[model samples]
Target: MLRMLPFLIVLALWIWAFIDCLTTPEEEVRHLPKVVWVIIILLFGEVLLGPIAWLVAGKQRAVRGPRQTPWAAGDTGNGGYERPRGRQLAPDDDPEFLASLKKDNKQHEDMLKQWEADLRRREEELRGKDDPDAGRRG
Candidate 1:
């Protein structure tokens, strides 16, 4: 309550330059057109010259530089802006998804060795039938 510190610092710089000129991106809105810099930060917002001319000439910011990342900086063709090439990493470091997971683990080990040779030929016909006329043929 210190005499409303310069009207709360000009209402937090007119709500941070009207939310940074409405999230600054209509192609980096420069000298004037993101709907006339949101109607000059809502009509000369209280008088700090339209949030100081939208934080000095409304937007065109960029200037960042170092952290590459478009898949290890491949696409140098900045115009079309491709950039994506390698270093993505997962799916077990993807060499064509680990060669289609080693050809589906060799077709699931040849269908588990033909279902363990049809469960050992159905356990050798239930252990060669012990004798009920050994499956009826005298």
Candidate 2:
């Protein structure tokens, strides 16, 4: 069990690093491209070097400071930066966004209906061609 402890620690660190690398946004990834970082983490994670490098440089670590938004300056009452506002609603939750999505979905449905009608017409025309007696019978 003692010998397995080291292996377990390394495995845990490797998993954490790999997950961290994958979840980190491309814009926040530092030093190397997100793809390269993923590769490095996979290739060297077992040796501890990959996880160490990733923790050190893969993602941009947020400094311990207040958040700043475009609307407000970083200044707070106590000489520290002010924290920004809370997160905004997701697109799906926004009424305007949902409306726009509905509009697009409607448009696509109309287009699909039209296409289906055209296909049916074309299929009928082919059937008419195949049966030379169709016109005569009509």
Find the candidate with the highest TM-score and give its number: 2
Q: Name every residue pair that clashes in candidate 2.
A: none
Can you write out model 1's per-residue Cα lDDT over 11-89, one digit (the tens) per residue? Answer: 8999998988888778888867888878877888888898888788888767898986544544556567556456666
Across residues 17-55, which tens digit of lDDT does each residue of candidate 2 receive?
Answer: 999999988999998899999899999989999999999
Q: Which residue pairs in candidate 1 have backbone atoms (N, alpha carbon, C) closer than 3 angstroms, thus clashing?
A: none
Deviation of model 2 at 47, angstroms: 0.8
Cα displacement (angstroms), candidate 2, residue 133, comes to: 39
lDDT of each: 0.82, 0.88
TM-score of each: 0.26, 0.49
Candidate 2 vs. true structure, TM-score: 0.49
Give the C-alpha miss distance for residue 121 in model 1, angstroms.
Answer: 1.1
